[model samples]
Target: MTDTSIPRADESLDDEATTPVAVDEEIEEETDVDAEEANGAGREKKSPADSELFRQSEIAADYVEGLLDILDYDGDIDELVSAGRPVVEVVGGRLQSLVGQRGATLEALQELTRLAVFRQTGTPSRLLLDVGGYRATRRKELAAVARNAVEKVKEYGEAVRLDPMSAFERKCVHDVVNAIAGVESESEGVEPNRRIVVRPVD
Candidate 1:
């Protein structure tokens, strides 16, 4: 999950460093509206996509803040709008454990945060959550892996099976293959252990 609370393009690093967001009213209002539309069941919730995006960031920020406080980690939470999306970034010392090896911890955290957003909004959120810039780094690596798979498929004329990855990672690979010519990708198996298969375009 990439950071749902990303800073706007013009927001400087200094602003991010100094600003502190506690409960965004815009988000609370949007979530309240969604809750009303959900009708106590998982029914339709009419809300602007952007508002849903904001709620995701707000929920994620709350989750991360609680985690930091419990673990006794010191990091300032910076929330802002970036690239037409909300993003929350945590920067501080001794925080690498939150990222975990291969970003397993970060992925878990994202799922939990998403659940939190769903519970509050009564509707699923499309929020991208990121911590320690792990997703950004992983994206570059996944793109490379996708290209390599495509090359192998072209050279050997056989499908390529990639190691199981989280849903976000699979989506990245799928997106890469989907954008390329003469290749295709699809996910197979159950999640937390799902895999991706790349094949030649028919």
Candidate 2:
């Protein structure tokens, strides 16, 4: 388990640049609203993260909903929070096409959803999008891969370089390795060529 005492993102994010615009004029304008209005009547401006997260979920939901309509598939969309990120999940039968083989379609849809969010909010969102249980399945697969890598590292006492993976896959492996007791993981090389390096903890 992660140490609970560590400085989490919630605490250290004050210095993080989350907004697309270095100095958002809209935020500055919001600060100048009449005190009475700002207190009671004016629109409460959302933080960049909140805005981007919301936009991402909405766009993904819309896209999925349209696809379902076209495919004549039935599903219910439930939007909510998971892992401290906005998630839109679709639950139904005959919707496997949305997820595609090995989640390739799901990953593609996620990228498009992120692009949609970026277009509207001008900020890149760290949005977690799941459909047809693809993410849950992938999580299990990644956990298994991490365990195998950790065993390899323990046996050889040398770093084990993993096969190339997408950023999402690398992130999953990194998270799993970080949670283990005697191993750590890092990504090396560049995109489309990058791989995870699993090694014994220092």
Q: What is candidate 2's lDDT per residue for 46-161, written digit by digit as tens? A: 45655555556776577667666767889998654333345678898887787776676776666555444554545665555677777667867987998999999999899999
**lDDT string, candidate 1, 1-202, tens digits:** 4333422346443433322221122221111223334443422342476566666677778777877877899988865434444557787778888888877787666556655555565555445566766677787798899999999999999999999987667766777888899999887877557789999988
In order, the Cα lDDT scores of the candidates are 0.66, 0.63
Please identify model 1 stretches exceeding 4 Å from their true place.
1-49, 81-86
Q: Total clashes, candidate 2?
A: 0
Query: Which regions of candidate 2 deviate over 4 angstroms?
Result: 1-56
| Model 2 RMSD vs true structure | 14.5
Of the candidates shown, which would achieve the greatest TM-score relative to the real structure? 1
